[model samples]
Target: MSVNPTPLKPSQIPQEAFDWYDAYAHGAMDRRTFMKKLGTLVAVGYSMTALTSALLPNYALAEQVSFNDPEIIASYEEFASPDGHGKGRGYLVKPTKEIAAFPAVLVIHENRGLNPYVKDVARRLAKAGYLAFAPDALFPVGGYPGNDDAGRALQRELDREKIQQDFVAAARHLKAHALSTGKLGAVGFCFGGYMVNYLAAIDSDLLDAGVPFYGTPAAESLRKNIKAPLLVQLGELDERVNASWPEYEQDLKRYKVDYQMHMYKNAHHGFHNDSTSRYDQANADLAWERTLAFFAKHLT
Candidate 1:
């Protein structure tokens, strides 16, 4: 008889493992170093595969809302991005009931390209009766490449300025979409979150509202020009990202930017990403509820 190894629970993992995983996921640590460190951290009985399985995102868990859900319609669409990669593509979703117009939002992905988790977020927004678009930053380089490590490497090769312009193009395209009511909002995680802040700063009139989940703020020069209301979410234990918060908050207040920030206790970086062991279900739920309400108040 063959025996299967029981899946390790999150509680069994050490905080250092989660921290290292975060660094690895964000591209701060190379795969070789991460694996070597991970080998040392994992318990003796557990295999490297088991440790990695627990650390990396399982896209299967990302499907909170189904792709075939009856309430929403989803598709891939291409849009112009002359200033970016010359062109861009995205996953667009909208309510199936068909209204004359709908409020639109741009869903931004992490350092990796537009993965299933981001696409699912678009569906969730559509199911809530809003038009949502999540663009693939890697489209010009052959899309997501079916895995995060490759996706990250591809993203790193592109000109960051052009990529930023790609997102700017995506925001413009979605806001002016035929089905859009011209009320535009944006929500992004990690790198996407940073993009939200960047968009709000550079193009003051672009976004009516913005939500950045554990992302770094834009440059001070750009941030001073922000016009949109913002909902900033952060994890208390995300020391690397949180280190910039005090200075960022000072600027927000000095400039009188319409913004509110929430730091979830006991949560780590990527806390809202349910696909990984760092996810805090309670914190994620509360943050999402707050995000939806914030959008409703501002986007509508």
Candidate 2:
């Protein structure tokens, strides 16, 4: 139940930790390399196991909800992508009793496709009464391999535009589902977060709201085209993602797109994902609460 490295004030963290996190997140450093680099922190008091444990999600944390949870109705469902992209499948989560038409939310994963963590995210959404669909970007290639690294490998090989189409198609299907009220929203992390920007930029008629967590902004030219309201969340310590924010804010303001941005202090990249050490539970929880409120305001 302990968070690895234990929670520390941002000022108390060592420089090596930030280096390792940046390298690992950018793929310049693999798990092994990250561990080797992080070893330095062990000398400073944290155990090697604790350090590693804090960064990657253990099985238990990766899935906080179960399929048999009293109100959960979960299953696999397929949707058609664009002609060339063919079809895709996603883990669908909904409430067991559907009293009326419910707004749907599309959960987009990071570079690793839809893994257990993302599935748990969808289930959490279902608990809030939304029909949640988490589409696997690896689907057209055979779906998530059940391993994060394996899924990342598959995700890297995808046709960029076609992958975008797959998401668009999934949104279309979710919006058309029998129990849907026709209002659709999206929440994406990392790569998926960037996709949220793309979705807002391109799918004006279908997507009504977007919440992109630490994602790259859509191209400036596309900013003016966005019709949905956006709630952008970022970690103050995430340099790579932060680098783009200044210019992105100018575009958002210049374009007049309805949007709100929040940057959490003392947080690094991927702060909202509880499966990793970067999980700033306090900040993550607040961001999530706001996200749900934002989605409710627009989707309902």
Candidate 3:
């Protein structure tokens, strides 16, 4: 009979010290130099990647998986109004393993449209045991202008009424889905984030929690109509929106709405989108943790 290998024990090694020997063995460092430098840092107790991975295997796996995993099934459902003028909408839906009715989240993509990044976010939410739906906000513009410059140009030409109708249709469709627990929340990035805020202002039935990352504020009249709690994320280094965040907070306070506003230092717009140059891993991770907690508090 073959013998199974013995599992490593944390007590066998110092947790705080970087494992230079392991690094060298894994090819992250050369053997001779790592051995020479290892002794110098042993006394100070430095943390190492190997040590952390060994201690928390789950953390390592979480970091390795992209927020949007393509393998996760995202069934697209299309809808159009009776007038034939409304642009059909597509939503990314991922179910959870939990048997009981679980809370659902609607994820809105940035100006890039309902691309891979948005799908990845939905997958992450599903992995966390929540039903996630990512709707294409740009369906009115022929779906994601493909390039940033062109997308913005198309955004300028979009009709607000058309987009609003699309959102409404998408919401109705998702609310009726079997996976939805009737407790719902919304999250959006960049342009999508702004639209989430807009939806909150208008729709009072389905929204329990809202998270808008670096999105623009809605009109004061609309803000007063929002019935859900909000957790808004902003980036201090994002010149485009950081300066205006104070005004947005003031509006939220003016309406006496339950809200939490966070500004990540040294981060920029699109920090949640890893495909973009403005992505900020630290801030995105923090935002995601907070978002899940918020949904759990309000929806669960």
Q: Which stretches of candidate 1 lie over 4 Å from their true place?
A: 43-46
Candidate 3 ranges beyond 4 A from true positions = 1-72, 80-87, 96-100, 140-142, 145-150
TM agreement with the true structure for every prediction? 0.97, 0.90, 0.71
lDDT of 3 by residue, 92-182 (tens): 5565354755677888876545666676677778777677787666666687655543554565566657666666666666666677788
lDDT of every predicted structure (CA atoms): 0.91, 0.85, 0.67
Which is the winner by lDDT between candidate 1 and candidate 3? 1
- The residue-by-residue lDDT of candidate 1 on 1-300, one tens digit each, is 965556667777777888888888788899999998988865565577778887888989989999899999899999999999999999999999857889999999999999988999899899988899999999999999989999999999999999999999999999999999999999999999999999999998899999999999999889789989999999988988999899999999999999999999988888888787777899999999998999899878
On TM-score, the candidate that comes out on top is 1
What C-alpha lDDT does candidate 1 achieve relative to the native structure? 0.91
Better of 1 and 2 by lDDT: 1
Q: Ten consecutive residues with minimal summed lDDT in candidate 2?
A: 3-12
From the highest lDDT down, the ranking of the candidates is 1, 2, 3
Which candidate has the top score in lDDT?
A: 1
